[model samples]
Target: MSLSLFIKYIHLFALGLLGCYLLRYYGDLNPVLASVLCGLLFSFLPFQSFIKSTKGQGAIYAGTFAAMSSSRVLNSINDFVLVCILGGLILTLFEGRFEGLGGRKGMIAFLAVAAFYMYRSVL
Candidate 1:
């Protein structure tokens, strides 16, 4: 990736982890509500760059889904962070492949979580 794109990816990854943290620990701890709140927050962000970057949005949304994972599925905050990063990378890789398909974001999130589990068990 180009230098700018790599930096943007890092930024998205951090935002994704933040989204996961907020969803998992914030008041009420409701994934649906937290995701909606995040969506709303993104909608109102003053930065046009974020508003226009679908990948950034997808990364955050994927992290929201990742946070929805149970403690049984993801043992610790470190695991959550890793899974969210995996999710963001998967989301970036799968971008445009599922364009116009609803729920692709959720699928990408699921893939990330599942991949982490599988990876853990295999090695």
Candidate 2:
């Protein structure tokens, strides 16, 4: 990925992680509420131009999905960050496809989480 794209991915990844952590700690550990509240908070940020972009929004979804794995799987911050980055990479990889489909973001997040689980288990 280009430097700009890579930077954007990381930005979005952080936003996602922030949302997840915020909700996990402050929002009663509800993934649905986490995503919703984070989405709303992000939408109102000053960086609306970037936040409104396709990749931008998708990155947040991917981040939340990745780190939302059960405690049984993601036992550490390392694991959480890895899965989140994996989701970000995957999101950036397929950022342009499936525009007409719903739940594609969740699907991508599932793939990232499953991949990380298999990686942690198989290795």
Candidate 3:
């Protein structure tokens, strides 16, 4: 497979595993719910939207790591930083204007990162 396709598959697999973890621990739902939720969260909605709308596939690819991080597969500041950086990358890439980022966009990003970390902590 091409490098890009390989990476995409890896991301999908990671997303699937994340779904499994979340359903088992966080969602406390059935296995079928895992597939449905992961499909909606990772494949159909946010990540896929990024792939369609921008050249920031790298950011999407990177941001998907947040799911893996949420799975508690790794525990480190580095993983947190990775999610933060990639979240910023996505915001910058899509918005195409970085000025006054300490305003609305920055707050949104902060909230998103905070929410992810909070959810992971609870799981």
Number of the top lDDT candidate: 2
Candidate number that wins on TM-score, 2 or 3: 2
Q: After superposing candidate 2, which stretches have Cα over 4 Å from the reference?
A: none
- Residues 2-120 of candidate 2: C-alpha lDDT, one tens digit per residue: 65776677668767866776687666767777777777777677786777886788787667765566768877778777776777677777767888999887888788789889899
Clashing pairs in 3: none
For model 1, the stretches where C-alpha displacement exceeds 4 angstroms are 1-10
Model 1, residue 68: distance off in Å is 1.3
Ranking by lDDT: 2, 1, 3
lDDT at 20, model 2: 79
lDDT, candidate 3, 29-123, per-residue tens? 66445545654555445545535443334333334334433345335545454445435544444444545443443343344456657666787
Question: Per-residue alpha-carbon lDDT of model 1 for 1-123, expressed as tens digits?
Answer: 244553455456556556655765656667778767776676577765753577767666666666576668777766766776676567556656978889887787788889988988888
Clashing pairs in 2: none
Instruction: Compute the lDDT for candidate 1.
Output: 0.67
RMSD (Å) of each candidate, 1 decimal: 2.6, 2.0, 13.6
Better of 2 and 3 by lDDT: 2
> Against the hidden true structure, what lDDT does model 3 obtain?
0.46
